[model samples]
Target: MRGPLVVLLCCMVALGACRREAPQTGPVDPSGDGQVTISGDDLVIADLNWTPPPVRIEEGAEGDARARAAEALGDDDLHATPASAIPLYLALSAISGEERAAAAGLRRARIRLLALGTMALDEADTGDSIAGLRAAHEFAAVARFLAADDPDVLTYLQRVDESDRLWELNRAAERALDAGELGEDGGGALAGFRQAAALRPGQPRAMQGLAAVESALIRRAEVAGSEGDFQTAARWLAHAAEVRPGMQTVVDARQRIQRMRATRIQRLRDEGVAALPKINGVAQARQRLAEILTIAEPGDPVARDLRQRIDRAVHYGDFRPGQVFTDALEGGARGPQMVVLPHGGFMMGALPGDADAEDNERPRHAVRFERGFAMGVREITVGEFRRFVETTGYQSRAVRRGFSMAYDERTGNFLRRSNVDWRSDYAGAPAADTLPVLHVSARDAQAYADWLSAQSGRRYRLPSEAEFEYAFRNGTSERYPWGEGTPPQGSGNMTGALDRSPSGRRWGNAFAGYGDGHWGPAPVGSFRPNPWGVHDLEGNVSEWMGDCWHATYRRAPADGSAWINPGCRDQVIRGGSWASSPAQTRASWRALAQVDTTNARIGFRVVRDL
Candidate 1:
């Protein structure tokens, strides 16, 4: 009756006639759904080109099927009835094989799925949503198979998938919000709404949820402000403003928090000032200043002045024990920062039964340090020393003398090479910027300290011999800082397994079975720190102390002061250099160097009074 029906009927007739033709001479190919044949001595193709007519129910019967499907879905009550009615419609589809059958099947599946999804969303039940979505998908797949290119079927299936996803995200978001896991740090209802909005743009419910979250954050800010946590309150209001700008509540909260913050800062400032006068020592004063810094706004003059007074107290060793500082030098250069050693008493010389202990370290006597002082965390580095030279045009003793004690790896001996200075590589090898600055004399080190003191407006000098020994011992009576062990793994950088290279070959001796993975002086802090949090205190280089060289401690000061002699020619050098043997690197080992002498194996670190 229609154009498509007429074409289908004609094609069926033509295919039926073609099916009667017999094969002429070749075997038949029956590997497909259609059949092959030979027609009157000519080749005939398969019958696949013909279209089959669709089975259909009578009009009254179709009306009955549709009504039954609707009743089974229970659309009026939004509840699913027994699925026994599904098979009835499926049997009808098998008999009819019609496009309308497929459409009916899709409609029934969509209705049940939508109803179930509605229930899940309204009740906020995730399990029911999943079950309904899976059932709908099965029906949708069958409908697609029946009418693979049906536009209405494709559209309805898309809607079903979107509904499933929207409800799932909504449920999750609601749960997070209920658990109080949302807002500024981000784990709540706000995140869920954003996901939903991304899925279905312009969604009214998602937008409403976002607005609710913003309002809640604003309220939290008000509560925090009332509790005197003005900083936290401001942070919350800022998060709200970010969500929705130009809110009157946020503007009002900002003003209120600012007023509260100023009053609170002033009260804290006064409290800190009153606490300062009551602080009897450097330790108490430092504690009070640290508290003031916590609440004080940046660049507040009261906080700044309080910090200055605290620094003065530390300078005279009036501050607390265990304080550390970063004393900036000229050109804003900083090295490894300093740490304050606790004021206490310990044996100042070598321990008993130390075979490596020299005569100079004998007659061990008790040394008491009443005032705590700060020491460098690491040795002075090349970069830090270079900054001083570049800023002040200052020359080191090695540079002025045009030569220093350098090692000749080729000959395996120490030699005074011409034109050799601090910049020269260890025995003519290139050195990194982080290695300790070597070839510096005692006077040259003092000059660096003077430069630092001028730049920082504070006192900086080398630690005295007693201070060096006390800090090295770190409250231990053992031979070494880490107890009695043969230079265990990761100890201070010394001549080790890796020292068989160019300059290392020249090193007289090295620790057997110990490898620090470096040939010469490694970078400052390259090895592990000592017990006192100080790095390379025993090995990188023999550090020069403020005290002059003394063969023995017969008349040494017991007050932890430098034992300087006006006419002394050599300065006390502690902490054996990299070129020294393991025995020479012992804690009790000591050496001496001319005050104006420079050597690649010698350098120094500074200490500030605290």
Candidate 2:
């Protein structure tokens, strides 16, 4: 309200010289118009129904008044002050006409502003922090309006610098939590977050950092308890509780740890470990290990070994240890399932013992992924590709070319046919939209990726040659993903005994014993997924990769990144198509074709950065 400002102005004019000649008293307005009435030398505002003590200045009293005002504004809990004391201090400064008093008044205003701003950066209450920050800004404007030339105003502005420091501290905490370094020393992101919270209360990001750090610590404590290191586990869980008091995760973890004490954590650990080898899939093994860790003690050798095994399995694509998620495209119209891969090293090429290994698959060079990424759980199906086309009005290369290679039963091999494109099946019937879109060129695949990237606000592109092979092998050096022999039944849609139809007769060579129950491309994800939770890497259709075609790995990049030559016209293709033979279905098999090459046997999947 303007009542405070009006009172301030009236008091300043009246007290400039301590020349109060007479009492200008008026009726106390019951209407509450916030009218100020001067009674004797004291000032009163009717709305507040409050009166200030008469201003009486003695020799050298200005210093004492200024000091007292400073002490009041500098209280530890200035935020709880009933009302701002700025106007009273200003009246004192006017009556005393001392530069020190004026400066003190401004200093007090600045102190209050800083207090509000400090609360904005580190408060535990997210809503309060936001409101506090806004209030701090408003207070700053008022202080500036009161005295534009005061040096204390600049001193108060330094809080902005403190806010920046708080930001860095919060960010450090986030980085530490995300990296899983919960140590109390330099590695402790929780420590930094707490420090920031102490400096500026109620910051949302800082609170989030604390929650993540505490959760990680709780998980560690669970592991430690399982390993019989109750002391260490208790310490970590206590620390988590201290950082995020009353957090449900901390409460649950504590209860679990207590239960482990009664049941003897080792029993569960032993049971889980014994079940690991019997598990049919990596996901099952990971689940068993996770159960063991919940009661295992921190730093337990057995728990450590199990964790390493799970990590290796996940990296090799034999296990998907994390949750499967989806990314929306076309403004949430399409959500494609994806699997996360961890950063790791793997032998990218074929093994030396493989009899069917080609020369191009030689050198068995090492490849590493420095960062994790997400891959589509299956090849991009016609349904997905259709969305991209409909949204962007994109024309695939096959469509523009007016023809693409398709299986011709009469020719008993793939032949170029007019009017054949991604929309047409090999038999010239309308292709099922659920199947992997075929007759799309490498360029067309990249275009679709580009469209997806633009629509989803993520980097979506074809996987590199190494990424494809890594996912295809799925932690195995076997010729085929399933095993050294023929692929298991219903493993993929590869050309098999089932392709014996008139249309299947076109592919003269097929895996002799295998019958995937499909002659042409089966609907995406119709068969079992690879160990990495990806479907149809061995069949459905051969996928285009981002790498430029290379005859050998003589100079290929050691990192799992695409190796592209700007001038190259051919791109690499991996994962055999449904028309491929047993040897062609081998994981290490690689092929090169013109960038614009389109065929019913070729389709693609996509990769996104994590």
Candidate 3:
């Protein structure tokens, strides 16, 4: 008896009672075969520390019962044949008064009970658990009656306790998982499962529980990312990875964050544009762009375009129409005083039924200023040009060519004169610094504008022809800059009938009974400014425009952009000078001259982007 029991216990130990197997369900045998089997949940725990129930051997059955039980237990498949062996083991425990025989029965029943109940997790198998429990209860009572202190008996008791712990862990894990206690929040299904796996690693129940928790976390991450909450998405994915590192689902979920950026940025842009045109529109739009750049990839065209529009909006918001300002230059000097113009639309050619209308002013069309810019409040002054020339030592076209068109006062006509430059006024004489600079080529004006740009870190350029006309009209489509009939007292310094030259010569065709104080160009801003708060736009020297000469208003730009081809020799000139006749001062008048042409009647002002 000891030999078979010893061999069985050795096998159980070597197989490691702590090692868990994947579930392999074997069918239960319902037939008890008249054996006294244990019945309810009560017996599972009640009999673990059993006491003896007065082992009085039956009077004449000890020898025969012992022989039959030993015969049943001798079979190698005794654990599976619990229906046959459990009854025999019980019979022997009762028939024989020997504690050794009872111990043998307890050992057989323990192995048999585990074989039946280890995987018998179904509640429907009350009969199987009862049979194992019944055998253990009866046999363990008698077996421990005298052998309670025996090493083998004590060892068997310890194994039964371990089995109970494993069962409890699995049940707790299952319940926690069903209750949505996934471990991202801590102290949930993951804790129970980890303990169970540590006790019996790679067990099916614990591994499945861990997988469930991981899957739930990944789903949460996906939901957050879809709604553009990438921060939350990243947090959840990180938690999922921590829960189970190297999980493919978490890795795939993390990749989706980058893919969602396109939709997110476009939505923000739409919101920003919609909010624009309000009082705080630019501020709101700027905030939206900041968020966009955080997620947008470098060089994204949509992001770049949004930034540019916002910058333009900022300029629009920062200034008001008719506002005056000046930029600081490098040496503490200031650029020309400038006045801001309002954005507007206007008819761009001659008015109907006006006698001064030329063919070039026909074919009227609409022109619009979508954004406002700052224009010089007055024509470029002689003092300003002297600073540029003295600073850069630049050679004007008149200086290089040694001659330019000037007022030949003796003949009462303009003619080429040597030594005439920007310093000389209309009469070919050195003039006061306050006078509008003259004898400057269009190229020279451009150079001065370039120098101002570099000094002030701003863009300074000649006005486009459309811009000049827009300022000339100042939002009114009048026949003349000052509107029809004889000129007002000091409307502009055009040729007048009462005007007298220094040599006592008077105009043959001029405004009747109208005379400015001096015959030649008046000092800049000497006359009242137009409605736009800009002086000398049409009355000072005619200003150089940035466009090349186009014979008519045909195919002109409606957006107020310069309609110029680079290197075109004949550049446009606009407005009226002191020598201009009444017809020349009409709002629709335009003319062109060679790029290198320099004359006393042509000077320039500048316009800068806001």
RMSD of each: 24.7, 26.5, 15.2
Which candidate number maximizes lDDT?
3
Model 3's TM-score against the true structure: 0.51
Model 1, 1-610: lDDT tens digits are 3332222222222223333222121221223111112223331121212122333446557657556655654532211222323433554555554447645764665455344334433322222223333334434544454454667556655665675676556556545654655556776667886887788775554554555556567667767766666667878888888765676757876787766666665665556556655646445655655655665567877668767666544443444455566866556666449887777788788778888778999788878876678889888988888888888999888888788878776777778977876676567454567888888888899998988888887789998988888888887777767676557888877777555764445244667666666666888888877667778877878898999888888878888889988988888888867777877777777888788888778888999865
Question: Candidate 2, residues 525-567: lDDT per residue as tens digits?
Answer: 9998877788988888999999998888988998889999997
Candidate 3 Cα outliers beyond 4 Å, as residue runs: 1-283, 286-317
| TM-score on alpha carbons, each prediction | 0.49, 0.49, 0.51
Rank order by lDDT, top first?
3, 2, 1
**Clash number by candidate, in order:** 6, 15, 1
Clashing pairs in 3: 38-130
Off-target runs (Cα >4 Å) in candidate 2 are: 1-321, 503-507
lDDT of model 2, residue 19: 32
Better of 1 and 3 by lDDT: 3
Span of ten consecutive residues with least summed lDDT in model 1: 27-36
The candidate scoring highest on TM-score is 3
